[model samples]
Target: MQATKRPDFIDQQYDFAAYIRNPEHNAAPDGIETRRMAIYRDLFYNNIENFAASAFPVIRAITSDERWHAMIRDFMVKHHCKTPLFLEIAQELLDYLQNEREPQADDYPFLLELAHYEWVELALSISEESAIGEDVDPNGDLITGIPQLSPLAWPLSYHYPVHRIGPEQIPDGETETHLVVYRDRHDAVHFLEINAVTARLLQLIQQNVAASGRELLESIATEMNHPQPQQIVSVGAEILLDLRHRDLLTGIHNIPER
Candidate 1:
């Protein structure tokens, strides 16, 4: 026996949703007034476009309105967002830019990286992770004790200076930009420009959470083959202290001297 057919109303609903999402591609459902359909389409598209503009203001500023609208419309029609949360929509755009969408001639070189930088700020602002525990000493020793990088801290490396990119300063040549983005106890998100050495040091600390400041510095000094290993150690000590003060390194694990 043949299976029963689905209701026409269901098909109509699907057609309507598709049209609302991408009126440029999908025609409006039959029997819907053109005026009413226009309202729905405008409302849906405007909401998404506004959200995207607010999330990536730099991108909005750089792109022409026609181009921006087309881009957002394409994203709305093509991208299948994973999360229902509105805040995650920015992430969906980032994923779309990074993985799904092909690079267009008019697109900025740092478009994806800049979107990612913006999304990081939003993600950190809404993060549920608590600050360092009360038991952790903020002013603990840097050399002897194990250093713990905060879950809120993130080390980011980009091919372009995403933080500095704007309508005026566009990327010209190949340049590596390293940044550390973190949230402090006050619930404020901060961005810090870092050098390759500092970036590598943060990476090492993140990978080896149990390593002491001195041990990490010694490894770095050895890696660099510095003429003055002691100087590296001294500077590393200062860096760790500064990181701790900024709440990026929550605290140190106090271990008794051997």
Candidate 2:
């Protein structure tokens, strides 16, 4: 007896979906008209392409139209995004650029970093975390109290000056770029470029939430082997105050009186 054959309908559905996703590589379903298939293909691809362009405006501006379209096509065809959410599609593109896509000579070396930098603002804007809480004291003493980094605040470091990259401002050499991206109380996302020391100070606060601002500064001063620890403490206090004012530090951690 001959083996049973699978129904053509199932195969046709798979073929049609594949063609819509990648017309260049896959053929149209056997019976479907080319014109109709083209409509589906264009619709699907255009939506994704438009979303990517909007999400990574800097990347789209810097790359040639030909290259940008090719990159989007590659992402559409190659990357199997896990999330069904539209917002997450941008993140999927970033993941593809960072881990899957091979670098091309014409592509900027900071392409992935810049894409990530752009995504950060969108991500922070949609984050569910509150900027400040009832437990936080906005006017707490920086020197005596534990400083709390806001959940919406992120300290990020990149090898390239991603924040400054644009069509005409491509950096020549790699430099350590330290940035703090935060959502303020007003629900606005802000980015601040800081030196390595300030970045480290934020990291210390993040790592040791129980440490008072003065203790954190003392630790930093010890690490730096500063000749005058008091001066470091003073400067560090000012830094803490600035961060607090910027809403990067939610406020001090309130401990009950003993």
Candidate 3:
């Protein structure tokens, strides 16, 4: 069958939206007054700009107005967001920063990482998932059982120390940063900066989901080639307990840890 022609009204809608997105290149649809078109342009742009501004306030604060407006324009012109919902603007901004936005000479080195860290905070804050589900025992023994990471808890690693990126404390050098972002039972989101060992331990739990706490620690000890495996296991037990206390874990696995 031959391809069906698109209706003129559909094409007109596309033309209108394209111009609103980037009036610099695409011409305004015919028969509309420039003054009226200006109103539509400003209204559309302002709504998007304002929502994205609230979504990424730190980005707004750290960025100079001229630079920030220029970048936001770049986002509007280049990125095709999948959703029109205001709540998803932060995620769209993060996607633009990571995948689409071209780097500028004045762009901060930590810009992408900072955006990701902030996006995680915002995403977890609005997530509907419960911290401790019925399957998870809030008071379960973490050391003797197979500990499970919570769905609400996200383990993240970055080359830059994103949590400390601010006006006065801007980092000039790279530091390996590991954080577990989680929402607590009280419905508060928190970021916990952890050492490489603890980060690796969390990874181990996810990898060996059926392994008991002692087994996981032993595996870590073996991975580290430590001569004193028992000591590593002992310390790891305490670490598991600490994570459990902080609601970082979803209690012990339902299957037997032994």
Candidate 4:
């Protein structure tokens, strides 16, 4: 079947947008004045670059001016963004980095992970997700009761220590870095680095949501073949309390006593 032709107005709009997004590659539409087009070009590109700079401040700071602008230009030119909203621009950029970005010799090996870390901070700050639930008890026994992991708390493992990357130094080597990025009740975002053991414990809690905190700790001990499982339980209890204090654990799930 033959495809229907798009309206001339649609083609004109596409030409205008294409040139504005990547003026170096695409020419301005037939009759548009260069002076008028310059305003749109600067306005559109600057808006995107400013937002990208804000969303990924660490990336912006550590990256050279030419490299940073090149990256933003590539994003605008190549990545097909899905949303038109400004708040979602960070997420869109993340999508571009993860899936669409072409590899470059000058790009940091940890660029993707670093972008994700930055995006998570912005995402959690603006998130409207609620931790409030009728089935959660603020002061319930973490060990004896089923603990509710806060949706606001994210458990992430990266090959690089994304949190440590900044203007000071790029660092030397990569290792398995586990972190929990969370938004507390006060709406402040925090990045907490945890050991491998703590990471596994959180993983167990997320997977076995119905199990009591004691059961979760015991499972970890069993997995490790630790003879003194009670010690694990004791220490894990303290860790749970610490998480509660930090608002990472939304407290114990208020399942009715059988």
TM-score, every prediction: 0.94, 0.92, 0.91, 0.95
Off by more than 4 A, model 2: 1-9, 255-258
Q: Per-residue CA lDDT of candidate 1, range 1-258, in tens? A: 999999999999999989988877788999989999999889988888888898889989988989898889889888998898788889999998888887898777777888999999998999999778555667788788878889899999999989987889887965899999999999999999999999999999889746788999999999999999999999999999899889899987776567
Pairs that collide in candidate 4 are none
Clashes counted in candidate 1 amount to 0
Q: Report clash pairs, candidate 2.
A: none
lDDT, candidate 3, 31-139, per-residue tens: 7899999999999889888987787777777888899888888888999989978889889988999999889888899899889888898899898886665667667
The TM-score of candidate 4 is 0.95
Global lDDT of each model?
Answer: 0.88, 0.89, 0.86, 0.91
Candidates 1 and 2: which is better by lDDT? Answer: 2
Stretches of candidate 4 exceeding 4 Å from the true structure = 1-5, 255-258
Those runs of model 3 whose alpha carbons end farther than 4 Å from true positions after fitting are 1-5, 254-258
How many clashes show up in model 4?
A: 0
lDDT of 1 at 157: 99
lDDT of 2 at 158: 99
lDDT of 2 by residue, 90-205 (tens): 89999999988889988777887899999999899889987776678878897888888899999999999999888889899899999999999899999999999999999998
lDDT of 1 at 68: 90
Best candidate (score: TM-score):
4
Q: Ten-residue segment with the worst summed lDDT in candidate 1?
A: 130-139
